[model samples]
Target: MSMQLNRQLPMPADLKAQHPLSPAVLERKAQRDREIREVFEGKSDKFIVIIGPCSADNQEALLEYVHRLAEINEAVKDRLLLIPRVYTNKPRTTGQGYKGMLHQPSPDKAPDLLEGIIAIRRMHIRVIEGTGLTAADEMLYPENRSYLDDVLSYEAVGARSVENQQHRLTASGMDIPVGMKNPTSGDLSVMLNSIQAAQSSHNFLYRGWDATTGGNPLAHAILRGGVDKYGTCVPNYHYEDLMRLLELYGERDLLNPAVIVDVNHSNSDKKYKEQIRITSEVLHSRSHSRELHKLVKGVMIESYLEEGCQPIEGERTYGKSITDPCLGWADTRSLIFSIAERA
Candidate 1:
């Protein structure tokens, strides 16, 4: 074999025990989970904002960012539900570069999976305990979900992973809301099929044993736009796009027929500053039609302390993203208030 086995890492159980969440944190997470679920289940009319850094590289900077969000949450709590993105596992298109805090606790340091696991859990715990807000993370590696399952209130299946069988099966089992993004190829059918799989019961191989899941009714759609055959960014967050998605959902017998428009990614063509305009446009689209207003749950924005991203190899700026560029604090706060007013 060409690959050498690295030292065995602790299982999720061991890691959980080592860096356990206090009862207060657990309680807060439970409450936040229920509230977020209510939004997807149509029990609540409040819109959700899954906003934060694209990749949480530094715990200090991330916590600082979340703290700021906490203040904004207070201002928008009546109209919006803020679920900050503590996305630790980033999906790399080329399977290289900074993979997030789950691979390297420190961006400049080497990869240490064991330490990375502990660090991520601890950071999550601190976020809940300090801010009383649970977070959202990307379920990049299906098997790794259990490590943070107890603390995470929301999970997203990236556009790249939405078509994977394991991702679909794992999403089916989650108790929290799992947002399934349109695949990079821009196929709505494929995305809906994945949502169907996730919203149905499944018995499959997970970890080292056979596991059965009773399905997740909170599974829903997230449109992050897509790449065309010739590499152009094709956006699908317009009024027409929402109508099309609503029509598609009408054909399916799925449970929580809702969608969250991701304003960044291909929707903005990775132009970070365009997030503000794209988000406003989605809200404008929602306001024009009652069907769209009901179908569109909320929007996702990648925002951090600083406005843009920096190279990972150099001396990085604190709070600036090392992965995807994100909206800075000032703009993010203003946008949240604007969304709350419109919502």
Candidate 2:
């Protein structure tokens, strides 16, 4: 066996006990959860903007970003809900590079899984305590969901993991909103199938027990675009693309048939600055048709305090992304108000 056994890590329950959330923080998280779920359930019409750094690598910087977002959230509480993307885990296309805060709590440090888990939880709690908003995180490792279950209000299954059965099953058990992204190959059917699985009851072996999930009706679609066979980026946030998704949803019996367009990734070909234009276009599409207005519930944006990204090795800049390039805070703030105006 080539795999070396690491020290046994503490269970999520034990860790939660060791460093728990305050009562006020718990109440705020619960309220945020309900509001987000209401949007998926069609009970609320407010738009969702899942925005934040691509990978939350620095705790201090991340909290500062969230605090700024909180001020904006207060100003736009009537029209929009801004949920930060405190993505502690990241998916690597080549299985190399920084895997996220879950692998290395500090970008410049080595892998320390135990400390990473604790650090992620603490960072998430701080976001809530300081900003009163629970964030979204990628469900990269389905087994690690419990570590963040209580603190995260939203979960996303990345394009790479969307078709995995374990991800589907784990999503089924989640009580909050879960966004399933189209596969890297841009297969809509694969994403729809994963959504179907997540919206159905399942009994599976999770951790050490036979876990049963009653199905997650809030499971929805997230269009982050995809790569073509020729390695070209294919965007799907256009009016025609959204219409196609609406037609696809019409053919299915899935619940809460909503879509959230990811403004970055292949949609803008990772051009961080393009997020502003992409978001405007998506909102325009939503305005042109009533069907789209209801079907397209929100958007996912990669934004941070500083615009763009930096190399992991040398002289890291504060508040900038260490992973995917992202929109800067100034553009991000303007974009949020723009979305609120049009959404």
**TM-score of model 1 relative to the true fold?**
0.99
* Cand. 2 TM to true fold: 0.99
* Consecutive 10-residue window with the lowest summed lDDT within model 1: 21-30
Write down the lDDT of every candidate, Cα atoms only. 0.93, 0.93
Worst 10-residue lDDT window for candidate 2 reads 125-134
Q: Per-residue CA lDDT of candidate 1, range 1-343, in tens?
A: 8998899988899888988888888788889988988998889999999999999999999999999999989988999999999999999999989998889998878999988888899999999988998999999999998999999999999999999999999999999999999999889999999999999999999999899999999999999999999999999998899999999999999998999999999999999999999999999998899888888999999999999899988687889998899999999989999999998
Candidate 2 Cα deviation (angstroms), residue 340: 1.1
RMSD in order of candidates? 0.8, 0.8
Superposed Cα deviation of residue 330, candidate 1 (Å) = 1.0
What would the per-residue lDDT of candidate 2 be over residues 133-211, giving only the tens digit for each residue?
A: 8999999999998988999999999999999999999999999999999998988999999999999999999999999
